[model samples]
Target: DAGITQSPRHKVTETGTPVTLRCHQTENHRYMYWYRQDPGHGLRLIHYSYGVKDTDKGEVSDGYSVSRSKTEDFLLTLESATSSQTSVYFCAIADRGNQPQHFGDGTRLSIL
Candidate 1:
């Protein structure tokens, strides 16, 4: 909580538009991730970066892209907003995959 924060904590946008959410961290952790949480399914990973410029797609990465050019910042961009993309986005960090993750509060996004 204290180590991570997401911008536009709440957002509403029209369908088929582009939206970008910013995730910032103060702990300088090496592993950062973006995940969306929905009703039944638990948090689904969208994308993650192991280090600056080194990233990978995750389970729900279809319309999303990510960039991390610095240790303290990671960005998530939705190429085309869809109603299905409406959900709470969370940013998390871990020293490594084996460690427990620390999460940001969340970003609530809505697509009309």
Candidate 2:
């Protein structure tokens, strides 16, 4: 569990629709991250927040956005979602940069 929870556990959406995933934490950590996993692409970071309102884009962030309003919540949204965005999403929390990150099981999303 790692004190993390991802909403909707599974989702099936159509192409061009909008989708949002929620990640909630009980650890009160300082860093929260959003990532996606695909067959050959592996896991890639989409966005991350170091603290409230302090977020930065990642390599594959062209279609994703994230917001963190507090230490316990991090939200990831895909505006006008596409089939390429169909992947398993993950949320992770880290108490310190040098420490290993703790991750949520993941949210499986499919865009038809």
Candidate 3:
């Protein structure tokens, strides 16, 4: 599990509460990403980081934010949880943008 690890493998939160999910990697990859997987949407990118303090919004960044203060850690934060945001989140890392990414098992989040 040195490649990647996601904390709080599962979580449940009430609507309007703030939730933060962590993704840790030991591979020291250059590209780290946050994605949410849902029934009809498949996998949707939420945010990504190219380097420390460098991040960008993705297709579904509306209700989420990300931070990367180090090479090994990437965090995804749901400012205020909502039922519509309930889904499995996955963290991925790659040496380069074009390289295949390695993904963590996933963090299942449910908001009531």
Highest lDDT against the true fold, candidate: 1
lDDT of 1 by residue, 7-102 (tens): 989999999999999999999889999999999999999999999999999999999999998999999999999999999999999988778999
| TM-score on alpha carbons, each prediction | 0.97, 0.96, 0.96
What is the full ranking by lDDT, best candidate first? 1, 3, 2
Query: Comparing candidate 2 with candidate 3, which one achieves the higher TM-score?
Result: 3
Give the per-residue lDDT digits (tens) of candidate 3, residues 1-112. 4399998899998999999999999998999999999988889999999999999999999989888989999999989999999999999999999989899999999999
Query: 1-112, model 2: which lDDT tens digit per residue?
Result: 5899999899999999999999999999999999999998888999999999999998899989888888899999999999989899999999975688899999999999
**Considering lDDT, which of the candidate structures 2 and 3 is the better prediction for this target?**
3
Measured with C-alpha atoms, the lDDT of residue 12 in candidate 1 is 96
Q: After superposing candidate 2 on the true structure, give the runs of residues whose Cα lies further than 4 Å from its correct spot.
A: none
Model 1 weakest 10-residue run by lDDT:
1-10
Global lDDT of each candidate: 0.94, 0.92, 0.93
RMSD of 2: 0.9
Candidate 3 Cα errors over 4 Å, as ranges: none
